[model samples]
Target: MQIKLRLMVALLGLLSVAATAAELPELIFPEGVGVNIHFVTEHTNDLDLIAAAGFKFVRMDFSWESTERKKGEYTWGDYEELTANLEKHGLRAIYILDYSNDLYEERVSSLHAITHEEQRGTASPQHPKSIAAYARWAAAAVEHFRGQHVIWEIWNEPNGYFWKPKPDVKQYLTLALAAAKAIRTQVPKAKIIGPATSGFDWPFMEEFLKSGVLEYLDAVSVHPYRDPGTPPETVTEDYKKLREMIGRLAPGGKKNLPIISGEWGYSSSTAGVLQEVQAQYLVRQQLVNMLNEVPLSIWYDWKNDGLDRGDNEHNFGTVTADLKPKPAYVAVKTLTHELSGYRILRRIEMDPKDYVLVCVNGSGGCKMVGWTTAKAHSVGVEMPFKSVHRITGMDGFGKGFTPKVKEGDLIFKVEQMPKYYAFE
Candidate 1:
């Protein structure tokens, strides 16, 4: 009887595997997924660091204050240097045009002042002339950087830190539309993204959509940063809400406009629980975005800027100031390497479990199931019962995995790896 029971269990497992295998397909790299970095100023060297860390794309801010401090007279020397460097290393730039030039001090101060009312009065859309001037400047900047950078984001977190008046969705959209129109006129082919909001700015987003603000932009941008301790289930819901908002804004495939998580990260410095939760959160978020077909999920600030490396605000970077890889950093590098050259086939959400089963198709007729945990859950991959692959830094290659299949799954657990992966 015991022998018969064991046989039954084995048969059931085999049957399940066979059934899944018939429907399973190889995994391929999803289109347009990327990482963000702040290499515009102090950490210019961090550009190479990011590239070395295996990131193909990087996002940086082109400060209006820095580029055109004076009116009509523009300087591209600094920008030129930065772009030239990125080009040399085969990295793509996603430039965000932020801050107001001194000429628009009244508008900048009024719109972005600490007090909500002061910011609103200063940044009122009534100042169409000033807004138009800024738009014109953006156009000139686009012309200057033409053919060099393709993705240009209008502003950073306009509904939050970027906007001083605090969450005036309509006014922010108005400014964005003005910028978009001006940019479109000059660089018709340029892909413009805007209204980069942080957290659950759904209320502002709803208002923007109601105003038909999405019509002017090519893509919607968001910065979804949960507290470090927030569970993966909550984060996933946040992204879902974001997607729903985007869908309502542009329905019926009218615009298959991609959503870019332009800024996201968790820092150890915030709290002890956050430190533990952030590593898993980073990994889970990346998997969710990719599986759901969000084009880009760029992390904020690749390197620490302050003296306290673990302080939540200062420690949002994937690496320390001197470039030591964090656990979150390792996880991203590993995932990117493993899932490279493969695109997502489909994602299945499991309720109560708070997990997702991501099936991917790739060359050589290989199928991979990426089990993404919502909180801190764990699972092993079955089939292809090879050894685990170890990925080192951004430039390092993937090491071979030992033959170990736990509960009918192959296990290829990792923290981070270089840009290239070598399977042995």
Candidate 2:
């Protein structure tokens, strides 16, 4: 009996030692990471809340129709308030000068008034001329905003719903190039990101790159959204395809241009999928994004729209209509906290359900590996470990939580829909 007890203690000690020697993965800023704030006009109250949640940047749309109601006259009222609020909350803005104005169109009194049919890319006779004029005017606006906002995206999802005729890559590029050149001429220091394709796999991106417009822009932007319940491994593949496409477009693989997943999120409230499943997928996607090294990723919007937009849109927000953080929001907060100071050393190829993130502390240079297991799974990390810290989320498995440890590696038995894991 004494021998058995001694063996059990020895086993426990071995497990503890293994956990301690495990290496923690470093969390590095791959590029420009941020969040998207649609419906800013309504969610202005949530700015402080968003910042408090640890988001570094906010991307807002400067709707053309909203800014310029009358012909040739411009207004900055909405933008002024929004930009000021963002600055107050310590967040940067990626302003999107979007859609067509009423005057720019022949019949529509305002942009909101335009039917989906009238507003699409079927430019009237005055379309090209109006676009060019709008470009020049937009340049002035960029100069006016100046230091308050630097990154400008030409439009939102021109290849998808925004495109009237449906996927007119050439026409969209024409307008985009014209606008980009005008903006550059006015705000020389400003960085311009374009296409802002609805999905990472836009049909026109490769063609546009070959056309030399890429030379005029600073970064490429994409909006890649899969169902929230999808696995992170799937999302990581999507990002890989995106990066590869960009590489193919650049000359001699020398493309130094940055890439931004300007819009990405899954809707949890959508029909057929459970809310918890949606939250889990959202968490996983963000982790995949971090590991893949995409610079900036913005969740679609802040507050939930009253209508779920076919149920999918309703599930995408970090907060509900009342500004309460959802499971997904908590997951992101936990991830940001875990990754706050470390840099990503390398992402290891474990099973799809199990992955290891390697990181080293910035100050002490102690390396650690955070082993995150989603579902019931196991994987191997190259590093030896001395200890293990099992961190669990507050509201249960996937709601987000931090691991507390003095000095050691981490072995996380992650359940479905959890946000992420970190190594110290």
Candidate 3:
């Protein structure tokens, strides 16, 4: 009876994969907005808040050290539960196949065995046997989760301290290539992406792209983070340059690789940015990515990791550690709910400071979101609305007002914070 039940579950998984396999596109938007979360089980309530905000994906680390306690064996029970919980909330998973297993190279005891400052996260799989073991484990994982809308990333931030003992492109590529090859050989339909580099390290990215790894990847994932004062618009040119580099380095069939805004966000630390500014940035960031045609944009954090008001790392969350909704949380909830099923139609730029994004939904409803990085100003935009529509602020607070019209154009106020003007 146990064997029969196991077979039934396996069959169901296969059936689920078969059903959704064909609908997986190279680029998806609005639906691709996600958040990076820390827990899989403990704070299950976070999933409820995440779902309420209309988040479609959750990016989390599927740690290797915890899974492969005994060499040649894997315990995916924790991640299985994580994925199951996410699925129940209508969320997808972007699992980072991360870190070195302590059972192999370096022979550390556990994930928390930190000796010194530099030796932190240095338990990387460098040995030949360890590399092979990691590859086998990756293949086994892909085979096990053969479907159900999970995207696998090879490693996280290999260009930074996450690689251990300094970042080496060659060393990272060796492990990545082996893992990618192993996963592809088993689960041919699996969506694998890699070189999840920290920030936009061009040299490391160019090296990784030139190494012929694109053949195994479905998209180019990156964490395009800028300074606290810098607006998210600064990433526009970087995206253009990265696309060009991908085109030049990728092989024939894989030249037009899509980009994923894997992990990025602003912290509302007391010493740095304001919570209100962070709120504005969150909405702008998602809109910028959507306009640039980025399939997925996973905000670095869903909730603050700690209560420290001065610690930058602890304050990137959209919500507080106690599950209290911050302005950023309300902003994201408002943005997603307001712009659901809408795609950017065009951008009408009047000047360097004025930015207007015309979006259209499936039901022929037109909405415009406009903002400015500089001082507040007004711009005239031609639309099809005959009556005054409700104007919603970035925080989803506003009122109905008739705008001044001239020559079949509606004048819109573009301020630091984005506002949605629905012209249905």
TM-score of each: 0.76, 0.78, 0.89
Stretches of candidate 2 exceeding 4 Å from the true structure: 1-33, 40-44, 107-126, 251-254, 307-310, 365-374, 378-412, 417-424
* Candidate 1 ranges beyond 4 A from true positions: 1-33, 41-44, 107-126, 251-255, 270-277, 348-362, 365-424
Q: What is the C-alpha local distance difference test score of candidate 1?
A: 0.60
Worst 10 residues of 3 by lDDT: 107-116
Q: CA shift at 304, candidate 1, in angstroms?
A: 1.2
lDDT of 3 by residue, 1-424 (tens): 2244345434544543532453233222458889999997756789999999989999999888888899788898888888889988999999999888767777332233213253344367777988999999999988988877799999998887677665788989999999999999999888998888878899999999999889998889999988998999988999999999999999998888779899989999987689998988988999888778786899978999898998887899999999999888888887887788776766886786677987665455567888999988778887645554543333243334555657767778888778887663
Over 1-424, each residue of candidate 2 has an lDDT whose tens digit, in order, gives 2244344434544443532232111124312446777655545568877886667778887777777777667888778777877788777788887876656655422121213333524332135877786787678778888877547888888766464435477777778778878888887777678778877654677777766677677677888766544555576676666667767776653375666778876665646355565556555555566667655677766667655556555656777877888776666665556556544455666665665555433342323333343444433233323433343323233344564333333434444544244322
**Residue 357 of model 3: what lDDT?**
83
Rank ordering of all candidates by lDDT, starting from the highest: 3, 2, 1
Name the runs in model 3 displaced over 4 angstroms. 1-29, 107-116, 120-122, 385-407
RMSD of each: 8.8, 9.4, 8.8
Alpha-carbon error at 234 in model 3, in Å? 0.6
- lDDT (10s digit) by residue, model 1, range 1-424: 2244344434544544532332211122423445666655445567666665556667888877677767777888877887888887667778888766547646444443323344332343325766777788788888898887557888777777456544566667777878888888888777678677776677877776656656666677887777555644456677677667677666455355667778877666746334434555665666666656555677765766665744555777677778877766665666666666554443434444434343323222233433333334444433421443532222222444443346645443332221222322
